[model samples]
Target: MKLRFWGVRGSFAMCGREVLRYGGNTTSIELVAASGTRLLIDLGTGATELAKLLMQGEFGRGQGELPILLSHTHLDHIQGLPFFTPFFVKGNRIRIVGADPPGLSLQATLQNQLAPHYSPLNGLENLAAGVSIDTIVPGSTFTLGEFEVETALVPHGNMWTTAFRVTADGKVVTFLSDVEYPEPEAPLPEALHLARHADLLIHDAMHSDDDYQLRRGWGHSPARAAISVAEKAAVRRLALFHHSPDATDAMIDETVWRARAETKIELFAAAEGSYLEV
Candidate 1:
């Protein structure tokens, strides 16, 4: 299995000279199995670009059925759905897997975002690659092609989000995204237990320790907290992701430096186009 980061910024997009090194797109990643099966994780603003890239080559043929695994319904996570070019293409289909959000139907949640009010692209009734949504419960395990996927519940922005553990070709990679660690310094029994002993753990490191106190309960963890989680989980490698939009290249470099100095785990900041073979 191979994992790639197409977008790693958190909350929103960032541009200009300050953010060039760490990139500016929000949370979207791809996991491709050895069997040539593709699993796209999260469809944030980066999904629009990914849609364009997917359409450029022979990728839209059979077995290109995209399975999108959504962590939650946060704006930064679902904002690009309406603009995904594949939806407008004929004979293509995308299956969206999301948590069964409280009170809101899956179809209603998608339609509300894609409908007239949110963006210019409206009325997806006629688009191809038309969405097929399925609500997934936590603790449920499913198979997508030759890979085994499992989900666990996590705290996120006053709502519940999912942490996914994917196993393919004898390798396990876990994605613990948009996770909020509680205060005053609560134990991470649940998260550590779920992510325990994975090959690679890609985590939400949207804040620095200095910013964590002010942003507590904001559905994101600081770089230090993310490192603690990875260390406790005993994962072989930790890839820090979901960078803050305001974080400059130099700031992120410092964060990664500090994180590495403090933890024994191999660490790297998640950047767009980064590839890791599992």
Candidate 2:
């Protein structure tokens, strides 16, 4: 299986010189298995670019059917749906999987994004991607092509979010977005179990210790908090993701260095276009 990152920023897309090193695209990743199955994670601003990439490769081929698994309905994660090019093209099948929170259903969550209050994509017919929505129950296990996925609930404000543990080609890859690690409690059981012994663990590290303290309950993890979770989970590799909008590339680099300095686990700052083979 090959894991490719299209966007890695958190909350919103970062731009200008301050974030050039880390990139400006928001959360979106593509996981391609040996059997040619494609799994898209998140539909952030980055998804627009990934959709373009997919279109470029679509010449002389049939419509591409891709599974888009969303962690939640946060604007930063699902805002790209309206801009995703494939959705405007007929025959392009996109399967959207997400959980519904108290205020909305899975379908309604997406509808809210496209409603008049947001944009002109107020109707499903306005989209050409031929989308199919599926609601996934958190804590349940499912299969997509040859990949086996286990979903678990995580603590997020108001809206419910999920952490995914995916197993494919004998490799385990876990993705945890917008997760908070409560302080003073050595290991966060939910995060640890999701990432435990995985070949690659992509986690949210949207703040530093100080920032985290100031933004408590915002549902984001500090860099050190993520590292501690990785350490306790015994993960082989950890990629810190969902960078805070204020966190520059340099700061992210520093955070990566600090994590490496503090632990033996291989640590990397998730970047756009980064690819990992497992």
Candidate 3:
């Protein structure tokens, strides 16, 4: 499998000199399973870029379908849905899975982003006929093309976000987003179930130790917390993601470096456009 990061920032998007190298778009990841299946892990601002890239490929003429497995409906995570170009064209299917918390359905919550007051377009109803939304059974296993996916709800504030463990072509990749790690204790069973022995672990590293203390219930994890979980899961590589909107390239680099020194597990801050093969 291969992975590409479109956005790694958390909370909100930002711009300016300090974050140029690391990027400012929110969380979204593109995955190419070893079997050649294309999958997307979030629809944050970065999804716009991935959309453009896809436009230059098979989806350019709008002839295929795509699956977007959401973590949650947080604005920073799903903000790009309205801007994704494929939805505007016919014959291009977009299957959105996973329902957010409270009570709204997955399709309904996403339509809210495109409500008349928010945009001129009339929400999901305005999209081409190919777009569809499906809700999944929490903590259940499913399949997409040749990829086997295991999903479970995670602790992410009022909204229920999902963690994914995907295995394809002999490689295991786990995605952990908008989630918090329990201090002084192992990660929850669901997380452990997904992450154990993963070839690559993409985890939220939106805080530092101090930041975590200040924002304990914000549904984010610090470098230490994320690394500790990675260590416990025995994942081979940890790509710290969902960077704090205020974090600069230097700060992320230093944090990743420090964590790398403390453990044998390979660690690095995820940068937009960077990719790795598994």
Weakest ten-residue segment in model 3 by summed lDDT: 180-189
Q: Global lDDT of each model?
A: 0.82, 0.83, 0.84
Residue-level lDDT tens digits of model 3 in 159-189: 6688999888889989987888666246787
lDDT of 1 at 47: 84
Ranking of predictions according to lDDT: 3, 2, 1
lDDT tens readout by residue for model 1, 1-278: 88878789999988788887778888888888888778889988888778887877444552257888898888888887777777777667688987876677766787777778776667557556567888888778998777688888888878888889888888888888898877423536777876788898999988989898789888898888778878888898999999998899899999999999998999999988756797
Estimate TM-scores for all models. Answer: 0.94, 0.95, 0.96
| Candidate 1 C-alpha RMSD relative to the actual structure | 1.7
Question: Could you tell which candidate, 2 or 3, scores higher by lDDT?
Answer: 3
Q: Is candidate 1 or 3 superior in TM-score?
A: 3
Off by over 4 Å in 2: 59-62
Clashing pairs in 3: none
Residue 105, candidate 2: C-alpha displacement in angstroms: 0.3
Candidate 2 per-residue lDDT over residues 1-278, each given as its tens digit: 89988889998887899988778889998998888788999999989888777888661143778888889988889878888888877777778987886667878767777888778878666786667888988998899778898999988755567899999889999998788755723546877888889999998888877787888888888888778878889999999999999988888888888878988988899988666785
